[model samples]
Target: MSWRIGDYLDQSDLDVIVVGIDCNEGLKRLDEYGPWKSNEMSDVFSAERQSIGGEGKEYVEFIVHELKSMIDEMYRTLPGETSMAGSSMGGLISTYAACVHPHAFKRVASISSAYWFNQKEIEELIKESDLSNIERFYMDIGTKENTESMTILHT
Candidate 1:
């Protein structure tokens, strides 16, 4: 999507820096050779299975603090200027990050998020969060996708 959005950004006069994170690094091949071989999806990204290995919290913390700090050191950034975007489970983590650190991530785009993975927890978190710091939040779901657990933000 980033590769295909240049024209749209130019037309909208949106100057932006896009950073792509490879969240699934080495997990695909790790399973073929070691005792650590396991289901990377559930281990790393699934909030519902967090007790086992849901490393999403660590991932989000790194993005919100470390990564943002590095970028801020290298460039000039204003308050509420950072944004996060992702699809599927990535979207889920992005949404989580926004809720957890709204001041750090002022804009979020969650496309087809896997809300069903931990619907109850996320819904509760959303209800408890203060999102006044967020500037823009874009959420979408495909017509063909299951809507059973899609987040229904009341604000």
Candidate 2:
């Protein structure tokens, strides 16, 4: 997150309003169990009622456009300086937001993004997206993390 939402949200000239919706949980939410989870998986993963990080993209769009509009109307913001940041599922969505809606975000900080949720789908989306307006993007994960599963699938 950029900065906590409250009276201090717009206090600084370079301040950012870190916003988040009720995304319920993390690891499970982006993969199999979650709150803003998708109802169907991509063709690569079989079309089922499993959550596959699709809803995460939609949620980010809502925040980048609708929610940001509301915030700009209420705060003194530096136009074109908006950024999105999050950890885990939130991190995954933050990166997705920049990949799909580059114009809405100038920077993206995705800490430990769960790209393992739908590796093929997410990777394809990022590869197919227009990242011209995304000035910067940061993504990271622990070396000892669950990347083993993703690595196996790729093999």
Winning candidate number (TM-score): 1
User: How good is model 1 by TM-score?
Assistant: 0.70
What residue pairs are clashing in model 2?
Answer: 28-33, 29-34
lDDT tens digits, residue span 7-100, model 1:
6676786668767775443433222211121232453434643323255676787777798888888876664688998877667777888888
Runs of candidate 2 with Cα error greater than 4 angstroms are: 1-14, 26-28, 31-53, 144-155
Candidate 1 local accuracy as lDDT? 0.67
lDDT string for model 2 (1-155, tens) is 33355556556564455655655454345642212344333333454444444456456656867889998888888658888877766676777777777888899988887655555667887889989998888878887776665555555
List TM-scores for all candidates, in order.
Answer: 0.70, 0.67
Model 2 RMSD vs true structure: 5.9
Model 1 residue 22 CA deviation in Å: 1.4
